[model samples]
Target: MKHRHILLVGASFSGAVIGRELAEAGHRVTVAEARSHVAGNCHTERDPETGVMVHIYGPHIFHTDDVEVWAYVNRFAQFRPYTNRVKITARGQVFSLPVNLHTINQFFGSTMRPDAARAFIAERSDTSITDPQTFEEQALRFIGRELYETFFKGYTAKQWGRHPHDLPASILKRLPVRFSYDDNYFSHEFQGMPAHGYTALVQTMLDHPNIEVVLNTTIDQAAASGYDHVFYSGPIDAWFGHALGRLAYRTLDFHRFSCEGDYQGCAVMNYADKDIPWTRITEHKHLSPWESHEGSVLYREHPRECGPGDIPYYPIRLVTEKQMLAEYVERAQAVRGITFVGRLGTYRYLDMDVTVREALDTARHYLACLERGTAMPAFTTSPL
Candidate 1:
């Protein structure tokens, strides 16, 4: 196959993985990042004062079931085994996350076995709702009113910037209620964190001779003709300059502070009360157990609506927003010489592993399209 110029927007996992693979395949790749650094939201940096690796945006734990993706990331940076065991503060006590058997037994002040605990929770759960319609209904049906109010209600409201009743039932399905003692936040077979940070990992990926990285450089549709094909990982609505309307998204605000010792015993401690304001408090030192730091950097995370010039975090695909997303999808489908990729481009909240997996698939699909002499799709992956 002949080499062609490729323009990739955003220097996150989506862009890094795709650009690296394509560059290795002899395609001249140009990566333009709006930020001054690579690794978009997963960007990690050492706190200048404390020497602790702080997740500049937030905590990103690399966990996936895909063996290939795990191996792919490991090739770039040394990955240290890390399991996220989150703790939550709710109703005046700390409890294990994912609501395990221990949590249920402790929460109710009763020593019950797994079978008894399962039966007890089932009795408490609202069985009348066969099919849950909203987030509130789903939680209530799964764990009953008390547990829902204690564990999920306020946190869910804060995280999405909407009342639980307004959010879809599917949003609550990612969390699992376990009858076992396993407290691992994610059930993926592989999980770990890079020894050196995500930025260093991405820098290594984009170190190919065929690739050119231009940080703090913004690329738009007008520059599409400069490259043979553009791999755009930017916001789909923003690509069109929000012509239809700005799709709703939730952004995060962090209140960063430093302390002499461990701020929180655990890496993450979520505040499950609306009155608390901030959703969670994260201690950067705990995230990397391999490194020891006398001083710790912490971030009190507050979630809110993504306003103008805010870094959009979670895409709120409410009913109306989904309709708007469909319009944006249609507009993108009509365009040529550009392929939309990644979370913002596809308008979905994707994990790091899934993003890398999709990037690999997108690059492979593009290569296949080239070999067949077929036109590359504007969206290799659909937003809706």
Candidate 2:
């Protein structure tokens, strides 16, 4: 077996997974992360004040229908059974998220079955707009004005700092209003949180004999050239020095506070009013129900435009950003011995399962390309 030196930038799931795979395949992999910690945005640490495992960035639930990914994560850490039942406060009323049967009944003050609820929403839906262009239009065509305005309008405005109509319709497609009583936030078959925390899980993955992790450092093209191949997971635009202009991204600022007992009864409580400064409050203790803690830690999330130093959460991917991403893709493709991978690298919003799945796929693809004596493309998965 031939061993090649590989440079992997960003020690998050993207870099860790690929580094582990390459290392196991007899390659010497070096992982460099700009952050002091390893897990990137998925980093988690124990709250000293409350003794609760806190998701430093935000809550990340491992939920996936992909059996291989589920099993792969389980190998690293014990995953406890957890279901995200989200609650939203809107117009002085609390309701279950996804606008389930109970939410519909409670919001309208009527006792209705699943079928009746379906018919009621259908009657209220704005049929005049056949082809919904924007998020606001999509909401009007499906859930009607009342549900949209009450639950989505104000929330969307605060979340994106823009009107729902100004944003793409794809944003609203992520949320689904269920007609059934199922309040589970995700519909995946396997859903759980790592018992120890995501950082521990990621650390376990990077614990390979053939791998060396270098933290508090960023890798540039010149520095990466010494390696046989480089797997970059940083922002795509940043890799090229943002020559085509910076891609749009949304970053979150959390106001962390400690409470005596239960702050919010649930793990997540969304404020669906524009007047509210923060978007949602997450109780760290609730996320780890398997452990008992005397105090609770809470984070009030506020979304804003990503700046130079802020951690980019999700790509905006509006028309202008897409165009700029296209330019970056062109420049990246011209480069050799480099492969951009993961959410930041591809400038796409990816879930944890999808990130792992893609990492597995990318490793396999890279191995195949090596065996065939072929050059690996800049991106294993298309960003656009």
Candidate 3:
């Protein structure tokens, strides 16, 4: 059996998972990370002043129904139960998120039951617009103008920096308007936060004898060719020096503040009004409800377009961006001795579980391809 030398860019969940798998399979894996920390966007560290676990980027609750992924993460660190109950301030009043039965009743000031609330919203909704195309249209068709303006309109504009009419309808589809009073943000069967921290978990994942992790090191195209095969998890456009121009991304700017005692009395409080410059305020201490803290640390999240040196949070896949991505994908496929994996590599927005699942699949596919004496394609999953 010939041992292969593989180069993996980025030390996040995707890179670490794939590197560990390949290293365990008798391959020498080298993980190159530009950031000093291991976890990328999911990085969490203890606040030096407040002694609270803070999500450096933003709150990332681990919620997924994938049984294998859940078990895999638990092997590294103990997961404490967590339910993301979000609250929103709209029209000078606080309401439960997802526009539940209680929220509908509170907004309308009626004691209507679930069925009656449903009927009331139906009456309020614009039934004339049968087929919704844009985000604004979808909101108006389902929840009516009042709810849309109060909750969705201002927030959507601030978050995306574009009018809801210009965005795709699918962006709003993930948000559910529930008839029940359930306040859990996600509908997944398993939901929790790692007891230690995401960075610690990632460090554990990269703790193999055959794996070498280089921090604060960015590998260029010249270094990529030295390895037997390369697994690039960095930005797809960066790999090619942005030959087709940079793909648009939305980056987040978080404002941190600390106060003694409880802050907002909740984990997350979203300001639905557009007047507010920042989108939401999250109390870090409340994120770990099991632990007690004398002081609280909070962050005001503001979303804007990505600029140079800014960490891209979300990919803005508009019509033009999709065409640009297609062109890059075509060029990427022609390259040999390299494979693109993970979210940035494939140029798609993916959750932690999906990233891990895809990394496992990519490693498995690579091994199977080698066993069959066949060459692996640049992307295991098609970006287009």
Candidate 4:
């Protein structure tokens, strides 16, 4: 097979994987990242002040049931087993998240077993709404008013800068209310953080003789035409200059502080109260329990409406936004020589492991298409 000139726009997880796969297949790959660094939001590095490995963008806990993805990343960087135990401060009391058996028992002052707890929750749950439409209805139907108000209502409002009623029901689909005492945030078979950090893993992925990386460089549509094929991991709407209306997105404002000792007892603490401006507080030192630091660094994560200058963190895929996305997808389908991959490109929230798994699948699909002499897919559902 003849080698092709592949241009990957964005040095994110998807781009890095695609670039590596294409290069290994004897294709000349050029990766251009608008940011100075690789690994997009999963970027992590050692703190200069405290010497603790910190997630510069946000906390990224790698968790997935896909063994293939686990093995693939492990080849690049050693992963340290880390389970996220999140605590929420609500109604002037700290409570374990996921509404586990302990949480239910403590909240109701009952010494009920897992089975009893489940029964108790079922009894307490509001059954008035048969067909749940919005996030508010979904939460109310499952956990009822008190628990929803204390835990989700305020947090959802703050996170999206909108009421829970405005959000779609699908957003609450994965919300777990465990009848057992488990407080683990994720139920994935494999869960951990990269020992050195995500940045190192990405650096390894991009380390190829045939792959050339250009950082702090933005590529426009005109530039993309030069390459044989283009892989875009940026926002799909933005790529087309938002011909359809701009999709709504929620961005975060992080306030960082350095302290002499530990401020929060745990790695993550959720402020569920409506009055609190920030959503959660994350301590960098706690992320790597293997290492200890004399001084600690913390970030107060505040969710805000994404503006023109703000960094887009999460897409607000409401009814209107989804309609707008459909229009953009139509435009994307009409375009050729461009493949959209990753969360931003597909406009969906994704975990670290899922991102890697999807990238791998995308690469394999691309190769299969070339081998069969067929047109490549415009978008990979697994990534979005």
Candidate 5:
């Protein structure tokens, strides 16, 4: 295979993983990260004030059932065992997340078994609404209005910056209601956090001699023209400069504050009440349970509309955004010598493990295309 110099627009997992795979294949990889750091949103740094490893973007727990992805990440960084047991403060009461049996029993002040609780929830659910359209309707159909309002209602509205009625029903499918007392936020068989934080893991991936990481550089499509192939991980709409229309996204504002000793006692504590300004307070120290820290650092996460100069967190793919995305994707297809990858590139929210999986698959797909003597398509994975 002829060695080709490939330009990756972002140095996050999407770019770093792809770079590593390609570099090992005798290809020169250039990873251009707009931010000063290599890890995009999964960036973690040691807090100078408290000596705690703070997730600069937010808390990211690696959890996935994909054995390949789990083993692949472990090769870069040693991972410590972790289970994300989320706690939610709803109506001044602390309850385990995923609306488990313990939470249901505690909420109603009744001792109910798994079968009884399941039946109870069924009775409470609105069977009248045969077809649930919006998020509110979906929650009511499955978990009933009481549980929906108590937990999902306020949090969903705050996270998306839109009313539940306007949101899609698919949004509510992520959260599961378990009859068992299992409070584990995710059911993935493989789950852990990188021992030295995500940044270290990414830095290790880009350590190959064939790979060069360019920090604080915004490499647009025009700038990437010199490369044989450009794996653009930046926003798909951004590549074309939003010629059709700007896709909607939700950005987060983190208010950092420190306190002596353990603050929340847990890694993540979500404020389920709408009255609370912030969505969740993440205690960084708790994230690294093995490490000892006298002082605790936390981030009060606030989600709002993504403006021109904001770091886009979640893509709000509403009806209008989807329509706009179709136009941008069409433009992306017509382009040559470029392939869009990653969450922002695809215009969707993705977990860290999924990002890694897709990155690995994309690299393999590109290699297969090259061997077959075929033109590499604009996108290895479908954005839609």
Candidate 6:
């Protein structure tokens, strides 16, 4: 088989994995990242003063049920077991997250078993509405208005910069209200954090003889024509220069500060009250429960509207934005030699494991196409 020149834009998890796979297959792969560093949003590094492995962008806990993805990441870096136990502060009281049995008991001031708690919550729930329409309705129908208002209402509004009523019902699909005492944030089969951090993991993926990395470089549409195959991990809308219309995205602003000692008790503390401007407070030291630090580094995360210059964090896929994305999908179908991969490429919020899994699947698909002498897909998993 003849070797092909593969150009991958964006050195994120998706781009890095695809580049490594293609490179190992005897294809010459070049990765171009607009940012100076790799590992896009999952970037992490140790604090110089405190010696804590800080999540530079935000907290990223790798968790997945896929055995292949878990084994694949372990090959690159050692992962330490870390389970996220988030706490929310509302009305001057701190409570366990995921609306667990402990949360229900504490909130109502009673000791209830799983069965009793389940019945109690059901009785409190508003079942008048048969079909839920929006995020607000879904939350109200499941946990009742009191819990929803105290836990999700203010936080959701602050995070998205809009009322929860405007958001789709699918946004609350992942929300879990447990009847048991389990407080783990994620229920994935495999869950851990990289001991050396995400940057190290990405570095290991890119450390291949056949893979060449060019950071702080932007690849234009014209430049993409030179490569035999193109893997674009950048924003799908930006690829077409927003010809259809720019998809709305929410960006985050972090206020970093160096504290003398421990700041927040936990790694994440959600401010559920509307009085608080910031959404959550994250202390770097608490992220790695196995390690300890003298001084601490903290970040007050504030969600903001994404503009041209701001770093896009979350894509706000509302009703109108989905329509615009459909138009972009139509345009992408006509484009050749390019395969859009990753969260931004698909314009959907994805976890670290899902992103890696998609990239691995994409690589396999590309190999299958090569063997069959078939054209590569312009988009994997419908953008619509």
TM-score of 1: 0.99
lDDT agreement of model 5 with the native: 0.93
Candidate 6 lDDT by residue in tens digits, 1-384 = 789999999999999999999999999999999998999999988888779999999999999999999999999999999999999999999999988999999998999999998898888888996799899999989999889999999999999999999998888878899998899999999999998999999999999999999999988898788899999999998899878878999999999998877777899999998779999999988888889788989999999999987888899998899999988988888988999998899999999999999999999899889999999998776767
**What is the lDDT of every predicted structure here?**
0.93, 0.93, 0.91, 0.88, 0.93, 0.91
Model 5: clashing residue pairs? Answer: none
TM-score of 4: 0.97
Per-candidate clashes come to 0, 0, 0, 0, 0, 0
The superposed Cα distance between candidate 6 and the true structure at residue 45, in angstroms, equals: 1.5
**Candidate 1 residues 1-384, lDDT tens each?**
999999999999999999999999999999999999999999999888889999999999999999999999999999999999999999899999989998898899999998998899999999999999999999999999988999999999889878999999999999999999999999999999999999999999999999999999888788666799898999999999999999999999999998998777999999999899999999999999999999999999999899989999999998899999999998888988888999999999999999999999999999999999999998877788
In model 1, where do residues sit more than 4 Å from their true spots? none
lDDT of 3 by residue, 1-384 (tens): 578999999999889999988999999999999999998898999999889999999998999999998998998889999999999998899998877888888888889988988888999899999989999999999999988999999999999999999998888888999888898989999999998889899999999999999999998799787898999999999999998999998999999999999978899999999999888999988889899999999999999999878998888889999999999999999999889888888889898999989998999999998898899899989888
In angstroms, how far off is 314's CA in candidate 3?
0.8
| Clash count (model 2, backbone only) | 0
Q: In model 4, which residue pairs have backbone atoms overlapping below 3 Å?
A: none
Q: What's model 4's overall lDDT? A: 0.88
Please give the RMSD of candidate 3 to the true structure.
1.1
**Which regions of candidate 2 fall more than 4 Å away from where they truly are?**
none
Superposed Cα deviation of residue 196, candidate 5 (Å): 0.4
In model 3, the clashing pairs are none
Comparing 2 with 3 on lDDT, the higher-scoring candidate is 2
In candidate 6, which residue pairs get closer than 3 Å at backbone N, Cα or C atoms, i.e. clash?
none
Question: Lowest-scoring 10 consecutive residues by lDDT in candidate 6?
Answer: 375-384
In order of appearance, the predictions have TM-scores of 0.99, 0.99, 0.98, 0.97, 0.99, 0.98
